[model samples]
Target chain A: MIKVSILGTGNVATHLFKAFSKSDEIEIIQVIGRNKKALLAFAPENKTTSDFSDLKESDVYIIALSDNYIKTVSEQLTIENKLIVHTSGSTPMNELSHHQRHGVFYPLQTFSKSNELDFKKVPICLEAKSKEDLALLKNLANLVSENVYEIHTEQRKSLHLAAVFVNNFTNHLYHLGSEICEENNVPFQILSPLIQETARKIETLSPYEAQTGPARRNDSNTITNQLEQIKKPELKAVYELLSKSIQATYGKEL
Target chain B: MIKVSILGTGNVATHLFKAFSKSDEIEIIQVIGRNKKALLAFAPENKTTSDFSDLKESDVYIIALSDNYIKTVSEQLTIENKLIVHTSGSTPMNELSHHQRHGVFYPLQTFSKSNELDFKKVPICLEAKSKEDLALLKNLANLVSENVYEIHTEQRKSLHLAAVFVNNFTNHLYHLGSEICEENNVPFQILSPLIQETARKIETLSPYEAQTGPARRNDSNTITNQLEQIKKPELKAVYELLSKSIQATYGKEL
Candidate 1:
């Protein structure tokens, strides 16, 4: 069994601990965190410690802390020559440079404490310094998830950026759409199927081939009507900017 | 049984044909389109007509043509006093004013020819000139979908605008994400679970509450890094604008 120590109490760490605990091939060696209250949530099943010096030896130490603390926390680790990694999308794998063997185990999915995610469907992007480390990381990731990729820092950065667009920006649009629905006395539930279908379409058609709307069609009448209907300045600005972007993407004029 | 005729042979029209054809309550009397090749695809099962004059009488006629052609096609419909409706999210119901009984039967979901949508899950927004017409439209809509809302012209307009943001603009973001993945030599499939989860989140959490990323957290360091990493001019502009918008949304400084 691969012994693992998860070094955080946040959503990603909690999730990783739970997932690892369920696996027959993995053993939870310890759960370490700064906050005792947070650490208590996972302490019942495994050894829990707040002191950096109390960390135990494990096959892999996953520093699932926030990006700002990743470097500082890695530098304070007592373990040596073990596979050390961080579960960050944007942070470079080098953040754990203090270790002789380090890698990344970034799960490319948003996590919430309340929402239980199926690790099997979540893609685990791995980056390591050596082929042996890479193979080991792949083995651990494969135990939990079907998708495992060898993503270097640059590629991981690109994925993170793209994620900001697809997840963050798209969620913002949903927020705006919800606002529009509320203002019109319409239930936001009406838009759920549309939202789900939009994501599902990319499974078959590329966004370029799948794009359809007033802006893509250059239907100025509908476009102008939409602009006039939007009251909020921020929302209007977003609608106008995205519309223009869609038009430009399609090689269409304003 | 509700006798209905569908105009246009686009994605919406084709999907509507298949949906109505399956329903025992609805009888598709005729399918009309200008393109013979497209019409041929639907000819084997139904009475297909290329000429507008050949349009037969039905209890309700659905104009599933593009937004630009809604008015032109509705004007050519020789049927009078019959309920004539257009399946467009953006087009105002008055676009079919030429007909005495006119309404909107907008199925508020992205329709693709290859994707067979469960109409029961698709929200069909209805609007009409009168209560009787609205009821008739609702009845026909209920035959196919569980979600049937009496959306007026203004509210439908708002919904349409929101749909643009959530569907068209969101799909564009997915396309951009795929492009980024391709450029980085990362399999785009790695991002699919992330995309699906983002959409699934708003089912329980509002988009405002669900929003997460550099901009939401006001992580200037990561935001700046992302801006620098994006090389494409259009992608960069979108990233910057969206970041500013997101910051503004959370009442944070750029």
Candidate 2:
């Protein structure tokens, strides 16, 4: 069985801990976090510690920390000759380069404390310095998820950026929709099915082909009406800019 | 049985036709369209006509045409004192006021010819000029969909505007993500789980509570890194503006 220790007590770390706990091929050696209170969630069944220097012996140490804390926390790990990986999309694998073996084990999904995620479907992006390390990471990743890819630092960087657009920015648009619904005394649930269908469409059709609306059609009359309806300046600007972008993207296709 | 005639042969019209076909309580007497070729899909199973004057007798007429064409199409119908409703989000119910009996039967979801939708889950927003007309439209809406709302013109205008943000604009964001994935040689499917999770999160949490990422956290380091990674001027602008909007939104909360 592959022995693993997870660092950080954030959503990603907690999720990885839970996912590894389910796999027969993996063993949770320890969970390290600076926040003693935050570590309580993982302390019950496994060894948990706030001291980074006194980490347990594990085959792989997964640092599931924030982007800024990744390098700092990796530097604190006094362990030697063991594989060290950070679960970050934007941060390169070399962020753990202080160690002899470094890699990236980023899960390309948003994690929520309240939600139960099926890790099997979550795509795990792996990167390592050596082929042996890569294979080891892949083996551990396969235990928890079926979708695994050996994405290098450059590709992972692009993936992270792309994710920000699709996940972070898309959620923001949902927020804007909710705000508009609230102002009009309409329940935000009215748009739930639409949101689900929008995501589902990309499964069968390319986002380019799946696209439809006033912007895609360049229906100037509806566009103008929508613009007039949006009272907030920021929302209006976003509406104008995105509408223009959609028109430009499809305009090129024709 | 509630007799209904569907006007136009667009995505909405065809989807409604398919939905009504499954319901035993709703009889689709005729499918009307100006384009003979487009009407062929429905011609095999039901009466299809191109001539506007040669319309069949039905309890209700559904004008599922483009926003601009709704009025013109309704005006062409010589039948009087019939429930003539338009399936449009932005077009006000009064757009069909020329008819003695006018209403709105808008489905609040994006319709695609390629996708098979569960009509029961689709939210059908109904509005009418009179109580009797409203009851008639609600009855027809209930025949196909389980989720029905009595949304007036002003409320529907906002709902449509909100939908543009959540559905249309959100799909555009997906397109942008796909472009980034292509450029980096990363399969767009990697982000699919993330996209789905983002949408699913709103079911349990409000969009404000569900929001996460660099902009939500105001992580300047990651935000700056992402901005630098985006090469195109237009995409860069979108990233910046959206990031700013997200920050502005959360900033007020603090």
Best model number under TM-score: 2
List, residue by residue over A1-254, the lDDT tens digit for candidate 1: 88899999999998898888889999889998889889888957459988888888899999999899999989888777899999999998887888889999999999989887888998898999889999999989989988888889989998998899899999988988888888888888899999999998887777889998888887887888788887878778788888888888777433
Highest lDDT: give the candidate number: 2
Q: Candidate 1, clashing residue pairs?
A: none
Q: Write the per-residue lDDT of candidate 2 for residues A113-194, one digit (tens) a residue.
A: 7799889999999999999999999999999999999899999999989988999999999999999999999999999999
Model 2, range B194-249, lDDT digits (tens) per residue?
99989998999999998899999989988887888889999999999999999999
lDDT of 1 by residue, B1-254 (tens): 99999898999998888888889999889998889889988956459988898878799988998888989878877777789999887777888888888999999998878887788898988988989989898889898889888888888888887788899989988888888989988888788898999999999999989989998998999988988898889888888888888888888444
RMSD, one per candidate, in order: 1.9, 1.2
TM-score of chain A of 1: 0.97
Show model 1 residue runs off by greater than 4 Å: A252-254, B252-254
